[model samples]
Target: MPNQAYLRVAGLSKRFGSGENAVAAIENLSFTLDEGRFLSILGPSGCGKSTLFNIIAGLMAPDSGDVTLNGESMLLRPGMTGYMLQKDLLLPWRTVADNIILSQTLHGVRRSKALDAALPDARACGLETMLRRRPDELSGGQRQRAALVRTLQTGKPLLLLDEPFGALDAITRLHLQELLTDVCMKKDKTVLFITHDVDEALLLSDEVLIMGSQPGRIIAHYHLPQEKPRTLKTLALPRLIEIKGEIMQLLDQEVKRHDPHA
Candidate 1:
């Protein structure tokens, strides 16, 4: 909301390999992500959405880029930000509660204390009864719920969601989107999500950032400007349809160029 950006990304560029083998994922891309808001990154496949997230997460560094968090350069701090992959990535050996507390344990939090601390929040995610059950015992939606709860338990300011609900059914995905909105609001988190689905971006993002293909770069930044608790009925509104049409047009153009036969 202020002049100072919560997350500042200047000249963010990523390159893979060298010379003939080289490929630029994102070339000199720059963007500012504000605090306490959700920013969605939408792009077709191979447009470096995940690559950008990895760079921001500190899992990978850009060849020529700068990332600053809260005015200071972003350092490689493991728990400062939480990242949830496309898959739930739960450990089958551990119980639902155990998986949530795993990060705390790595941070030197003892088992009993970890469980005691994580119990209430995990329960809120509907994993209370399943804390004693294994990951193998849960449904797809349940696994995702546990994964979401686990990601939240870390208390990270930056939540990097890489299509967290992409694998679920349409009905389940809708519920999870609402659930995610509720969780993010309650936690006051700054979230950056990479999702291929346009409707999902429109539904959840405070601002949707579309990226270009090949040498990935930001193409457009559209603010939803809608209040909290955006529902399916809201999607039917004229403004929503207009925005959706705009995004769909961009997507259609990209798809035609990328794959004419599709």
Candidate 2:
């Protein structure tokens, strides 16, 4: 049987400013993410990708339409999902372990219990030795790993990632991609990821949605083959290459459609 929809965004619309100066950032956008599946959104810059995420994260409200999690409205409820943005956003004063358990601490989980619960994830991500180190003491990749642990500690059924690895170096990015895939699968968390990289989207996603500019809207959807969990080795497969080319073509078409001169 097909997987049930765990998250749904239907006819969502958002506009900035008003009257003649108003800009429609998103219009009639709709999509569904299945339970435990990873879905990636791809589009050109200023195509409302971040706008869509902000709306989904409850940081902003759409002018129309609805966002539902587990069949319930998610409007204005920021805690409904765990969100990881482009930056790790670690607290400078906190140690790695402290930062990882920050969410639990906020939720009244005792510090001792939160740290204990975070230990396994820290170890799994290779940060066991640096648990007590502050964010400034760690490398960029290490900080991002710690941030991932913190997101996981929230224990939310859904995760919203907005280009979390976009700032990392290529090698570190690939490593984190692998790590994220493993963690999500093992934990059975549903993910909605926004990214500009086609290969990254293809590697990390079960389904990829391509958005168009000028009032961002999903113009194409591709359901990727998931015979097995994707890894760096998956990049070498002919099917992956084919899908990448197709996605690139679609994106190019979108660009040209918006800018005829190009």
Candidate 3:
């Protein structure tokens, strides 16, 4: 609502191919994220969530739109924000500690200094013991933990995570969700996360945006409470339950609209 939102996307539109074979990824999509707010986007597959993220991360340019961070246009700037994918993408040969500090290493920060800075986060993520091991030596959850530390080590204020915990087991996912919230919120990082799970969105986001398909437009938005240190128990609250139901219904409607037989 303010003139200079922390992150703002205006009239975003992206399409693939041309004319007859063209497909609309996102159409006139727009949203604003305030500083230090954690926001999650819920949408069906092929709803342009990743496409939007790519644009925001400067990995890809939108056909039409503008992405701004702190009133500065981010159109051609890559690496201005932290971007993490579902895959850990850690180098096979690098040790966990080395991998976690890769971003800072590339940015001209000394390895020793980066390691010193990342030590606290590595311990908090339960990666203190595994830091000496390589990615192949770690379990899926451990790898994700290493990846998370790596993302945070970038020291970028805005983080774009695409299903960072989606591949882990239920318990691991839950633990990492809490870890992510605690680390990001305490550090005053603004997060825009993409997840298909309604409960994950509800539990983690300060606000949730439900996206519709076909053209990938926002159809619903829910502002969640400011409660902190939320756990699985918090999802059981009546208000969250009701909102979850509403989100489910809206997603179901979007699915049926895109595929009537679904």
Error of 1 at 4 (Å): 1.6
Clashes of 3: 0
lDDT (10s digit) by residue, model 3, range 70-177: 998888689989999999999999999999999999989998999999999999999998888989999999999999999999899999999999898999998899
Q: Over 4 Å off in model 1, which ranges?
A: none
Candidate 2 structure quality by residue, lDDT tens digits, 1-262: 6554679899999999999999999999999888998999999988999998888888899999999987888877788789998899999998888899999999999999999898898888999999889899998999999999999999998998999999999999989998999999999999999999998998889999999988899989889985447776787799888888989999999988888887
What TM-score against the true fold does each predicted structure earn? 0.95, 0.96, 0.97
Predicted candidate 1 versus true structure: per-residue lDDT over 1-262, tens digit per residue? 6578999889998889899999889988888988988999888888889988888888787888788889877645545688999899999899988999888898999999989988877877878888999999999999999999889888788899999999999988987898899989888899999898988888888999888887898888898867877887778888878998988888777767778997
Judged by TM-score, which candidate is best? 3
lDDT, model 3, position 163: 94
TM-score of predicted structure 1: 0.95
lDDT of 1 at 192: 95
